[model samples]
Target: MVEKESSRHPEVALSLPFTGLWLARNSPARRVPSHGTDLFGERYAIDFVGVDERRRTAGHRDWRTFLATEPADRFFAYGRPILAPADGTVVEVHDGEIDHAGRRSQLALVPYMLGQAARVRQGVRAVAGNYLVIALPGGAFVALVHLRAGSVRVSPGEVVTAGQHVAACGNSGNSTQPHLHMQVMETRDFSVARGVPMAFRHFRERPRGARQFHTREYGVPAEGAVVEPLPLPGAHSTS
Candidate 1:
């Protein structure tokens, strides 16, 4: 069931949840009800798919790209470390779902899309797959979903700082490809939670097809923009 947003929801400040370049999809900067529904506290949710310098989702494509499902690991986002967006305590964690194969072919996606309702009916585990819910200081809860199977590192009640690694990206639950699905919510129980607005704190973004990048002090990246976190002060180089 979809929950309606209140007249006003304050925006929560967060850091980008992963390192390296990623393409933003279903961003609230593009539209409200970002994912096209208020179900599962996704009204302001955003998705990020890791991409290469040339912006390819995968290093290569083959018959599976057009006619069938591909291995989840074939996508650049698969297994990439998923970081904590803010200082918080792990309040919930689910790591039982299997990381499924990825789908890029419309033929493969067609049947998957038809199963969306069934997945929702199966509840949070079926739709969110392996996931983590972190409780922020002021009561908002941030959810990182579709995590790689067997990759969750923190247990419930564990405290975590911003930029700390929590899991890895994976193709699971309702996703078509390996990507991170993120959102903030009014409550810890997503089954009845309402969406909360959110913005990433410091990052660099290059719009799709653009030649240069721009720094964002604190805001949501536009849909299709490739984004990465600005290096933290004095951090050593690592790729």
Candidate 2:
């Protein structure tokens, strides 16, 4: 895919929403309209799949991995805490969706992909699942979607600080597996919002297959790279 030209909107700086290693996917640093479409303010959206020290997405792979759906709890990302990426006021929250089983098999994925259009047409609840929208100081809205059912802790209008735990990752909505899907947009209503470029602050990234990690002071992670937040002096990393 061709890289999109730079956006006219100023980039928003954010903190990585979770601790522990994660695999970056559909990164805006790789291309604009990062998810391959501009719908639902996803142009700059990115996905992070939780991984272990060995970079495995799950502890075990069995017949289900190749032929059917797996339990959502089997994935490393499932139930992992999802945090606030910046200090902001919660503008919206949705927690009514049920967490679904995860799919890895091509057979399973094919049918799911075919239903993409229907999901989109069903509106935000179908697409985003359990989610939260934070209104940042400068008119930017940060959204974190596909969260675990019943895990949301904050409500609309509550103030949250960066790194505050707000929910957990889950296989919900249009997700094929448990992961975090995040994006910054121009407005709280994603239906009419425009995606805004965003960068994470103070994270360390290791390219796939490499043992060493490099620190990024302020930047978007490269697609396919494994990343974790840089350790803070008094903060302990959680799984």
Structural similarity to truth (TM-score) of each candidate: 0.94, 0.94
lDDT by residue (tens digit), candidate 1, 8-52: 457888889899999999999999899999999998999999999
Tell me how candidate 2 scores on lDDT: 0.91
lDDT of candidate 1? 0.90
Question: Model 1 clash tally?
Answer: 0
Backbone clash count for every predicted candidate, in the order shown:
0, 0
Query: Model 2: per-residue lDDT, tens digit, 73-137?
Result: 99999999998998899999999899989999998899999999999999999999999999999
Over 4 Å off, model 1: 1-9, 233-239
Model 2 lDDT at residue 185 = 89
